[model samples]
Target: MRLNNKVIIVTGSCTGIGKAIALRCVAEGASVVVHGLEQDLGEAVINEIEKDKGVLQIEEITNEGAPERLVELAVKTFGKLDAVVNNAAMILSSNMETTDLAFLRKVLDVNTVAPFALIKAAFPYLAKEGGCVLNIGSVNAWSGEPNLFAYSVSKGALMTMTRNLGDTLFRESGVRVNQINPGWVLTETEIQRKRSQGLKDDWYKDISSVYAPAGRILWPSEIAAAAIYWLANESGPISGQVVDLEQYPLIGRNPPKN
Candidate 1:
């Protein structure tokens, strides 16, 4: 196993991309700590991992000292922390002109501030173990999306944080930091939302024709594969880079050609 004996924490892992990353980590022989707000969903993920005989832990990380609590729990249960995937965030549809201050603050608090706090809190353990940090950013960070203003800004800040932390750790400590920017993913929620909005199979065709160069939306498992590679592989030399999950052939590329 690539991640044999490694200990990792994945936040917001109850569902979506985070869940996929946690499952992948467990498969790679790493003891995983699953953190999220939903107790039932978090437990379900833990159960899934446990069924495979993978050692796992669970925690509900909210605004109050969640990052510290998660790190402390990992150390207490597993004895050490090796990697952390800061994959927790919220996606809201609101532009600058229409978005309220409360909404903007909430989005930043969850998407940007929390990741930084977790990284800072986990720094000591990561430094000791020469571990790495993988942040789940978004393609919106680079593109100008109209309605997802707060989300885009938060992810943009996350990319900057990744670079800044990676440089600091590279120079001062052995810990590595990187970011993963996923494009439009077909999660369960998205699928259901599409259906609710009366979007049928042809909607997918429309989306593919419009956005994805590969003619398909990204799957959570694909993003998970990237996360696993960054965590399990000795690819520390490539730290501070943002891995875009969109099937575009170039960075900042969008609106796939027909």
Candidate 2:
């Protein structure tokens, strides 16, 4: 019960990594507020939680007042807030030729602005409770593949936001901010996207070593484990760290042999 009696908010918890983190937090004894755009998927996640341990709220992160309402809901339901995992994001594959400026702004709004808004809205409660803000970033924030133009840019801003706030907040209000940069996770959306790109049904089974050094890509649960450690108070007095979760160092790596 590492997080016993804690109250946590996990956005985009309807599926994939966000769902895993919410489930993990619940298992560790936290009462959770699960937010997502999909009603049925959100309910599906809720069904797995222990009785009275989780509440589901359907929300679009980019909507007006959504962040404030989310924070208010968590505080209202749980009586207070202890942590927030800003895990909701929009990912699209488009190169410069295909990506328009408007779409790029839309990506930034969802990926970066939304997280920042949530952070601000939750700050008062977090400060009172000495809480944690954990952001789910991507290794692509380092410089994604050319096709992920807008996505990469958005995540890069998120990285900077994490560091800037982490350094300031923990020192000022005892609220810790941190981020995780994950690589090649095998989530439902990713599988579907890969399939749409013409990959075979068992594509994961044949993943190349360059992408998945352990013979497979990362699992959402694996990322959740690290997230829990950082969010838990036992880690103590640490903040502003961006962990690169990958098979190889992100920079200066040799090109994969195709």
Clashes of 2: 0
Q: Which parts of model 2 are misplaced by more than 4 Å?
A: 256-258
The 10-residue segment of model 1 with minimum total lDDT is: 52-61
lDDT, candidate 1, 83-172, per-residue tens: 999998887678878888988888898899988888889999999998999999998898537878998999999999999988888779
* Tens digit of per-residue lDDT, candidate 2, span 1-258: 999999999999999999999999999999999999999999999999999999988979999999999999898888999999999999889889989999999999999999999999999999999999999999999999898999999999999999999999988999999999999999999999899989998899997788778999999999999899988989798899899988888899886767
Report the error of model 2 at residue 47, Å.
0.5
What local distance difference test score does each model get?
0.83, 0.93
What TM-score would each prediction reach against the true structure? 0.90, 0.98
Q: Judged by lDDT, which candidate is best?
A: 2
* Best-performing candidate as measured by TM-score: 2
